[model samples]
Target: MAVGSVALAGTVSGGEFANPHLCQKGQQLLLYFRTIYGKQILAGYNVYPHTPDDYQQTGRHAAIWGRDIQWLGDVDEVIAHVQRHGYILTLHWHWFFGGDSAWTRERKTPVVLDQLLKPGTPEHDTLMRELSKTADVLEKLQQAGIVVLWRPLHEIDGGWFWWTDLQHPENTAELWRVMFRYFTEERKLNNLIWVYSAGVGDLKKKPPEWRRRFYPGDQYVDIAGIDIYGVDLQQDETPYWDYFRAMEEICPGKTLALCECDAIPNPDKMVAGKTPCWLYALPWWGCPHPRRSVDWARFTMGHPQVITLDELPLFDDASYAPELGILRPADDGGAWFPNSVPVIEGFVAGRGSPVDLLQFLVDDKVVAEIRHPPRDFSWTWPGDLHGTFELTARAYDAAGKQNLSNRIHIAVGVRNAARSRSVRASSGTNPEAAVDGSYYSGWHAAKDAEDAWIEVDLGSPVEISQVNLIWGWKIHPAKFAVEISRSAPDDSERSWETVSLLEDLPWQPWKATHRVRFAPRIARAVRVHAYQRAAHQTWAGYDLAEIEIPIPAR
Candidate 1:
């Protein structure tokens, strides 16, 4: 399925839809994001009713220019929302020249199309001014240090959007050049990076002249991109790869991006890391409207790569895990980014100090919470802990008192260790802060025995989708695997349950990265072990550079 020939999904047998927007993915770009999009991207509304359905079918994720984009009342609502809750606002500009087709089918009312398509009129100038007004917003946001991946009039070669039928490819290209040159080159807006896109199916089919016409010129473009929403790709074996091959041939050396993509999942399986410079990836908004599912919360947090506008910063943070109740909190001065709350479990160690803890997200929202020390028996939070200087206990079942644990409410501030502690993922850089004084433990080593491996405290049982194993001699036959047991960190004799393994790579100064995904299984702690041998003796040592923990579906 090399993409020279792509079968249309909704077409009849022997009939092919050959317009070039069909998606055959090449490399899965890891994008990280959140579920919220608001005022920051208000300009996207210029495209009109920029509905989620439009996003799926047309590849327009809201960069519009119109007076109606913002609510008349209080614009601060969106501004405060992002500041307090860590919601992301994506900036996108889409083409609107075509009369609309299948994806837009009967949805973009004719009235809307008329307004968008009517170029060179007073009304259009006013529209342009309105869009330009969003510049004020972008400038202000830049001062605030918010990053925007500004994509304007994307995928020109497809001939479906506004660039259609424009005289002289240079004229359309000039339009693009003027936009950024005026905004950045002249205006000195350095924070904005351009994403140049095209969805024209096969590069071979394009005559040199036509392909040349599609480009807005390389000077203004920063990132090469494409948009693909497949209807029947899941039915095929290699749906996305072939689609990417088409773009790869067209763009040649430039990195191809999923400008506005959600055609498939498990992009990590397709594109592993930054080696080939797959660079930045941000998927379309989480189903833009009520059509968005709650599961999007999981999708936003679980995938190591994919991110919504809301969770964009998490990719740079590298530690936020939404599953364990930790979330990417908006930057709180010097506080560790991406907080977590206590993730409750059905069981806890009785007659023991609580090893569990709480962490927050980037938004500083309560992601999870753990009742640090068990109440010496099975107990639940019967009421809010607003202690009146003493502890209270109540029994659930007096008839079976032996089986029931009494409810206990005690003042917690003096014992809340989290007040002075930091929530973070385990790493070599954090050896002192590595263990939370928790009971769980396992070992992970780096290049050798002295490489210093620390057992990650899982805090609680969780299913992990993928684990990153890095740093080992590629030529070495050393095989690495993780072992899990109910064993405490101090004890090495506890029974171990081996789960995942890592294959050694050609050890370079920068280790070749590998992503290992498996069915989600709950484990409290994992030990990474690498098997190696020497002449006349056999030895096992572990080496790692970076590790990415992806959570699978529950």
Candidate 2:
């Protein structure tokens, strides 16, 4: 759903900028010169594997994704490239999916960690050792003053990463505890900010107890992130926006992030102002199509609600991309610029077939439409070009359920940079569960074509804690114990190992969920992989409500 057009903000591409400033939010993007794309390794123009046209390309890590990269250039070569770009050098465990879902060691050596995620094994040890090595790399980056915004173990709720084997919550916590100790305690490296992210999935519909099983708390993460990609209005984008609103409310005290994001497609659509549907119920806009084009730089430069590299890059002043005309004052939408009225029309949401998301800027009185006739509709400029407005669109299906839209934003006279907002906003609400301290219940629901969840955090290190589930009020609540696993903080850098099983206790009103706390072996986090383990049931299904752990609160 995320997509946006790139503006080679007129920086002398070859040479680095002489300034040393972290690109602050709301500032224009100063031209950035990087040879990598996302978190994967990329062979720069001076390195091997660089195509003849590498110089013409926008990013270096163009095609690579995942851990265990086979780089043609060594870390020194990477440093050299960074010197040339002279902005902030960026490296990431970019793609943590596919091919056994683990780190690949030797360049392109296809070593995965999927098998290692399972309970109890030597492979798990190997994973931990490898993580220590990765920490070494992070340490180096830290020394460079290159504030690395490393997001290693992201999207935990999705059963994709090594720490989330649904059957091993304790193991997950153990792994996090080990990672935290290795990085924060042993390594003594603190120049980096850690981000724990989840896909922009709804957590509201889920029961409170089920959401606590995978709660990696504020103690572990520096920034609580949610990966939000823009969506084409042609499809429902409620889920993405809902996450934004939820975070605004529940995580008011925590720093928020669109840790990973994509601009909704069609640079033209943004020309007008805001997306309409967002004014209403948030919906998932994952229609089948590639509306993802806008890069992170463009987005951070524009939106200030979320924290991004521009907010704090190693090199000062690296945050803003000034050349994109982002800092310039908007000239009343249509009347001000040469292309002011240019209509921006295309798929704002992913629809089965392409749908029109007609948009045009307004400066004075000029008008432009991005879509052609027949498909395009008409509208007029109402108030001040840069003034915010709640726009409504008209379209309907046979049922008149209304293929509708509504959004709020301002036009001309706004800041010159795309980031300079004509309006202001808050991060929004979290899940109902967070209201009480039930972690996931409030803001971390998994509502899609999948089974729901429950999770937890041991608070501080503790031994095999009792994972008590309140199955029912009756006979020995079927035996559904909470499982656990521990992983390296950078789960992608290593793997996971199963820890133990804490079984059921007396049923509580909060569904069949609760846990026992002891002066257990000290560890950091724990997760309960919900399961329907008791074979003999009339319904033959698993159901859990809430999860609790008795921790000596810090």
lDDT of 2 by residue, 10-107 (tens): 33321121112222210122222121111111111112221111111111111111122223236555544443333333233533333243433322
lDDT by residue (1-554, candidate 1, tens digit) is 01111112221221111111111110001111111111111112222223222222121222221222133233354445334323234456542323243223342632232343357865456545644665666666556444445666666666555443334555556566656655664445545545677653554575435655757655566456666554232233343555455555555544455554443334334334211213333444333333323244234333434333222232221221111111211111111212222122222221111224332121122333334433222223323322111112221111221111111112221122122222222333433232332111112333344223334545556555445433322212245566655655556686667676655434432123344556766655655554542221123333243333434212
Question: Top model by TM-score, which number?
Answer: 1
Superposed Cα deviation of residue 432, candidate 1 (Å): 57
Candidate 2 regions exceeding 4 Å error are: 1-73, 86-100, 103-121, 168-170, 202-212, 233-237, 245-252, 264-289, 293-554
Highest lDDT, which number? 1
lDDT score for residue 500 of model 2: 47
